[model samples]
Target: MMKKYVCQYTIIRFLPYVETGEFANIGILMAAINQPYFGFEVIPSKHHGRITNFFDQLNKDTFRETVKVLRDELERVKDNIDFQTPNTSNYQDVAKMIFENIVANKETIVRYSDPRVLITNDPAKELDKLYKRYVERDFATKPHNDQVLEKGIREILQLNHLNKQFKQAKVGDKRFEVRFPFVKRMDGEPLKIIKPLHLRDKEPTKIREHGGTWWQKFVQLQDLNLLPEKVLVPYVGPLANDDSYDACESIIEKIRGLDIEVVQTSEESRILEFAAE
Candidate 1:
């Protein structure tokens, strides 16, 4: 049985006028002490209307730019803490500091309720749950299309009776490492690695960033000679004529150059054939 870890989280809010004390929940930050997990999820783009309504005089562009800057800074802090690199403070303290920095101005108010604790097998999923509960009004109606590719791959594995043979695997040496989504073993030795790449994000920038990150990892693994022999990348191809499509294509080409197999999620027959082997 997997151990359940305790997580503490706070809701990030925006205050247009500090004196008025009126604010809106704009994002969430979560962290766990015993685990190296920390992340932030922001309100969806559709929620901009709530901000504008709350602060009739606020400039939408300025608000967006501020949020972007805050997110970038928070991500930088998370990276340092996650990697266990040299940092001035501990993870929880740094999280609180970043939150304070974001809400320091009069236009933005960052206030978190008393920290709430929860036990979860996956901290990331718990963060999503909190975000949906506090931030997304239409959470129930939203489709979980982001997980479609992964679900499909898992289904194929189960259908082929290969689910028991595969487990999550880690690659790389002590200096750096990455967890492959799934790995199949033959006689207790890793035989193949499976990675699911979802390239159908609504934002082109997200698609580009995801592709670039994976490409960099592939390069790193190649340099370290840690590239698996029968690696499989299951991808959800982006819509035609969209920039995301181009981004996905570029990543596919790079992975293929390394002789790793790339299979489209829509290619159900091909996926099953690969899994059967």
Candidate 2:
């Protein structure tokens, strides 16, 4: 049923009806109190498709206009209910109420990404570093270009160089933390990365010895479909560089192949594309 809805149409349309308005913010409040999900069809595809067709047949634009009028009327008298509550309340209580309503009505999911090997935290700066290190190198020279470092020191130096580029860009947002979901390797072992392991230039061997906690978290992320419609994949290396560009391209391709819409943002270009079945 869920799959049917996703296949049929992008579900963002219904969101507007429940959205708040300036003079009348009661739609959200009504949705919160009545708990719409309790009575409405849990399988959105079944009910919403019919509702959409009905609205369209009745002239969608006019129907939507009528809905706004009806909402305004409802909002005017919402306070007359028996359980009239005070406006000022605990922010936590309001937050919890909103969260519970949304969680019941919507799918919640987790997203993960690899942290910049050098910078353990903060992604915007790391993204900038990724762009500069790979982009600014002397591409014309043989020894200086495309040379994969053998020793751990060289790799660490490279990562440090990348870090400086990240720092220079001033892209670091203090609020963001890095996380990634791990899919099992071909051998059925969970993916894990240890602190010292990032120094290794090559992809680390998939093993429990690297870090069991990380592996456990990886499994946990996959087990729960906590990640909803909004899927966030973090690119660790760099955005502007050839490698990062290729990585971005490949990821976009894969995501589009699954028919998911995507928007790419960078210092230069902002492009939006959608995947439809």
Candidate 3:
């Protein structure tokens, strides 16, 4: 019979901008509980170009330097485990101790997720599999970036104990509907919509196009009287000093022209107050 050992693993996330609470999985760290196996895999520099393109505003060196530091630390610990004193009888305990130390709660850009358990006879193969599924994940379509913005708002609401009051829903007739991430309803009909818009695109034209799409939806929904009584849009985008700020603001102004509420995504107080009403 092939022996199976239990293992624990966590994703290593790279948060380019901690303020937004958005992160990307850059690596995987897997450690076995009953064996002397502990290994890690991180995205190499060759693939960092894709990350740089996605986070265009970031300093390319920021990620490189941080990841290098983490990798070096992991290596140091792995080396220590190899030269343990004869007094040390339990390699598993050493691996566990080292794993916990590395994944301890961190506020820095490189952070670890909650450790997850799995059973595997092969930790190295499992690490590679997880690394491919997470760190090397396909970025073109999981709606990953948009989900991050929505998740930030959801976490804020959850922290305030107001998350249960809203849900993801559509607030219009079958023919014309707009799905919102956070919505409040009255008697099964939507009364308020809390929408988080991602306008932080590298290109100004892309920002306007996205905002314009929502603008038209608002207009058409208004024409049909299906627009909710209140709409709170929390938008994230380039800064005021950036060249693309004007385009982002233009779309925001247009949405406001329609009497829709717009607030900066960072304005949690305004969003919370609006949600409470």
* Model 3 score (lDDT): 0.79
Q: How do all the candidates rank in terms of TM-score, highest first?
A: 3, 1, 2
Best by lDDT: 3
- Predicted candidate 2 versus true structure: per-residue lDDT over 45-133, tens digit per residue: 22233334322222345435534654453344333221343343443244335434333444211111121123123333443443333
- Give model 1 RMSD, 1 decimal: 19.1
Scored against the true structure, residue 141 in model 3 reaches a CA lDDT of: 27
lDDT of 3 by residue, 1-277 (tens): 8778789999988876554344667899887787777788888755677777555456778878888888898888777886772235588788888899889958678889889999987778888998877666534423465678899999999999999999997777755666678989889988888878878766685576567667776876788899886998898889888888988899999889888999988999999999887
Top model number, TM-score? 3
In model 2, what lDDT does residue 203 have? Answer: 19
The estimated TM-scores of all candidates read 0.48, 0.20, 0.52
In candidate 1, the residue pairs with backbone N, CA or C atoms under 3 Å apart (3 or more residues apart, or in different chains) clash, namely 15-109
| Candidate 1 global lDDT | 0.67
Off by over 4 Å in 2: 1-59, 62-83, 87-95, 106-251, 255-277
Candidates 2 and 3 compared: the better one by TM-score is 3
